[model samples]
Target: MTLSLTELAACFEGVIPSILCTVGADGTPNISYLSHVTRLDDEHVGLSDQFFSKTARNIRENPRAALLVVNPHDGAQYRLDLQYCETVGSGPVFERMAADLRATSAQVGMTDVMRLRGVAIHRVLGLRAVRSPLAAAPPEAWRGSALPRMAAVVDAFADRTELGEIVDAALDALEAAFRHGATMILLHDPARDCFVTLGSRGYGRTGIGADVLPGEGLIGLSGKEGRAIRVSDASRLRRFGAAVEASSEQENRTRSVALPSLPGAMSQIALPMATQGRIRGVLFLESPKRLAFSAEDEAALALIARQLAAAIALSEADAAEAAPDAPIPRRPSEVASPHIRVVHHAHDDSVFIEHDYLIKGVPGRILIHMLEAFLSAGQVDFSNREIRTDRALRLPGLKDNLETRLLLLRRRLEDKNAPIRLLRLSRGRIRLHVAGYPIVISDRKSGAQ
Candidate 1:
């Protein structure tokens, strides 16, 4: 396989890292992705192998090989088959590769949970570079065909959206985003001063949905410190609390590359979610791979986080607009003081709602927040007030008709297997029948041990 020098150079600049593969003696080929590839001076091209495998061994024995690079987005993948005369490894090179590998894994959410032994290499053979569709090639082909994947996540803010539909779509998209391993949405509860795992994707057998407190584990520290944390090993991190009894809960919460240990959390970027110039919450991404998050990936994720913050703010505004308005319910002068919280026990959980303040495409935003607020505050009996009804009438679409909305809210609460009913009163009062979960106060602690 051969390519014009120009085409070969273009491949080097594409989105997907060029992979160096090696075959074990028996023919089991070990191929992994790479992030760095460059020509040492002018003759040899150097590549990193933080994702240590048998690629080096295979290259050492056969000297015949292939290189693959592709666009990360929806672009065509490209391959190069060539020969390498020698293979090499240096202490610094190994260290650098390992670092890059860990960073890349963190950004994309890949956790191998394997012992990373070391990094190796493949020395390029004679000057016979190759490219795709190689037969007829201009020694100097112009660049354009295969380029690096460029993706930017935008948090769209708008006045109103079809919330139920958008949430349904977003949930599906979120699942796809975390198809590889444990993907979660870490929401900031200013009241609690901690981050909670609201949604999870691809979790392992053990229950990971449990909460974590700030400075309690790896995730917690990131939330508390408001910065990214990296660990090279997990067993040694003192911050990881005692072992959980759950069978799936490993003694070592995360493989260490830095310091703290959070369950299923290693090499994480605790990107804070903020809007209106304030840090409202955080987005904690964990990868079992050491140094999982890369610079480019971090940049992308940071941008996504910014978009998320904007989206949440927009969703909140939209939600406000949707609140009952046909007949404005008398605003209750007394909402149980934000500081007072008590747990009323029922055989079920509290009302669960996703209130992204800024995501515009989601319709029925404001009404939902109010529903959530009522549900969140339900356990404390509203004393037969007319707040709920009055507010429903005031809302635009409700026409003071909160029966349907309440019914839907009730259905959702029941679907979650919650035994408690957060009841609404005459105007806009809300209360709960069974024990309620402790309302998160801005100053309270959050998450599991």
Candidate 2:
């Protein structure tokens, strides 16, 4: 079969190191190792500039170079004849390379040493397979055109009525349309300036309510920079300060404190969701095999994220209504079982339950607010409008994510096995089931209440 550099896109995902052979002015050869290489297009590739002083000098004197890249999945190798194009010191290419290098550095514990100076773009003159006895495995099956699937996914969003249902529909469409193995959706927390996982699938740990600050990890970096972040070889980069705190009920609860990725994940792509010029959240997709996503996947998912963001924005207030009248049990009938001490630190919006940290940021503040309401009014059912209009929330954005924060707080409480429980009564109404745990609320500055 005829060979093309673009056909070997999997080999250029920067999962495995590549070799660069350059000719010096005197005809001597210099070889350098490349930590990262990305396919710029069908005819070009971008190589990360690291400690390649000699290779750079050789390339300058003689613009001819040979690149040897290997497919990490199948051990397939190819040699490409390259003609030096030019160096890109800034722009999108440089920024993506820098972000990826930071992930690589952290994987090898070289965050302080590795620095990206520029990206050396190269035009592929030709490509040929290296002779070997081991036969290369067949290439992965392509998902074909995403247009038809994208249409279906978008249509699914149009059919959903409730906000939570829309979130579920978005995830279902992603998995069904793209064939992505693991998928998750995170909501941006404006008050805390962080992203929290609200829903996820295809993970051992759902990581719901897990918080990611800007630049913390891949998901965090994506939300922080308001751009897409794609990484193959996710195993190494997965734990770079990325952990999901599992509920204490799980046997491996200790491991959950960190952010989580799909188990045995080799590739991941994070796309930021934006609506009306503001980033709302991020959509993360992962696969167990390497190079699971391509440029098409990235572009398609970005478009999907944009559409979903608008849907989410429109649905955020779908829950704003008066509390529904139902046969709600009286608080006095439900006798308290245990006393759970709760602390709210206003300084950082942190919450601790029974001396164990439960949640922080806006969600934490919301939890405290709920406890205060329960204590004062013996109220069990609360509506979205009530929470949104509450003077205590001080929600700091054009869009109030009261419902989303409630989703997060509920998940955190469930994971921690806290006595307090949040039960959804209807679209905009939630009933707090505080059985066996009487909450004692106290401010960070003042004494107990």
Candidate 3:
């Protein structure tokens, strides 16, 4: 039988949570509550265990394993079984797994419930589902180590694809994310200051996505606030009604198409892509399932949102490089902030980078990047040198010209007013001269506009 699992897993967007059966060193197999088993790309699955445990030790001994999951429904007897021949436990692999579990779980109404149990990561293996006798009769017809055919649809995303290519891939991923059967991605049109659905899938004869007003829908909230927002019980919410766009005839068209019935998009997620502290566009994922966005799901989508930002940045950079007339903007000592919108809640600590005193905007941004580079070098070295204008060349044209930018950059550095002056522009070379206490720039990446 088709089992729905994921601790309160969003019926549509919920992350299918599970416990993996692993053979320990003594050859005894055991299981534990796995808060982390999530999709990494389409072909692979990841496992996340908190601290070190028998399950982790089992994976360390032998990577072969099967993750078990039982939903709250299905008479408490049914579960969705995912057979993973491979596993990745520690390092960054668990990052996605842990995040997905948290988001999906949270969406299910259990916030802060995903505890990794502090299991030390043992091994990460690549898995292939071991087919069972009940591989037929549709995915819902059977369970126990069963992987649906649609899992193939997940393989569309890649870490390294052009932004244009990724846009298409993103639309597909969005459909999977929402499981709205099919979905569309609308980018915030900066020129028009409006939202427009750019791509879609899984519909016939009509598509949705007319230009929407700012701060109106989930997509609007994402672009306006620069955070990923998921909406549940869309119909019940007074703010949202039914979509007005039409679906397309092409089942796998590049542009978005409306689903036959909007596939019960009870929950939706909108992620705004940004980089280097600049907002790029929006990635809207709609789900047919109510309560689809679990906390783990939200976290997973947030990571994907970040990944999307990087992908978009890299892709656009590639495109700009390819075009003769289009100039890709890059200056020296420039660091990016993923270009997504940031929440401006007032906290005691500052999120923006600095060198003690308040340094705002790009001028402040450059100095911080420099401080980072120098401090990382160990030992404050620049001393006994006069300031010069050529420092502007280091980060081309934050000012009017190389000469003027240097003057601006140097003045900010001098104003720090610390025990010793670490940075001094001497001759054509910029210097970082400090007497004692190696000056290290704070951990921040602020920008202006």
- On lDDT, the leading prediction is 2
Better of 1 and 2 by lDDT: 2
What lDDT would each prediction earn against the true structure? 0.41, 0.77, 0.44
Which candidate, 1 or 3, would have the higher lDDT against the true structure? Answer: 3
Per-candidate alpha-carbon RMSD to the true structure:
14.3, 4.0, 19.5
Ranking by lDDT: 2, 3, 1
- Name the lDDT of candidate 1: 0.41
Give the Cα error of residue 50 in candidate 1, in Å: 26
Cα shift from native, residue 146, model 2 (Å) = 3.7
For every model shown, the clashing-pair count is: 74, 12, 60
Candidate 1 Cα deviation (angstroms), residue 105 = 21
Q: How high is each candidate's TM-score?
A: 0.39, 0.84, 0.36
Q: Give per-residue CA lDDT, model 1, range 315-385, as digits (tens).
A: 44444344443533323223433332322111112212221111110112222334345555432433212
Best candidate per TM-score, number?
A: 2
Candidate order by TM-score, highest to lowest?
2, 1, 3
Off by over 4 Å in 2: 1-4, 71-76, 99-113, 148-156, 172-180, 235-238, 242-257, 320-346, 353-356, 444-449
C-alpha lDDT (0 to 100) for residue 1 of candidate 3: 32
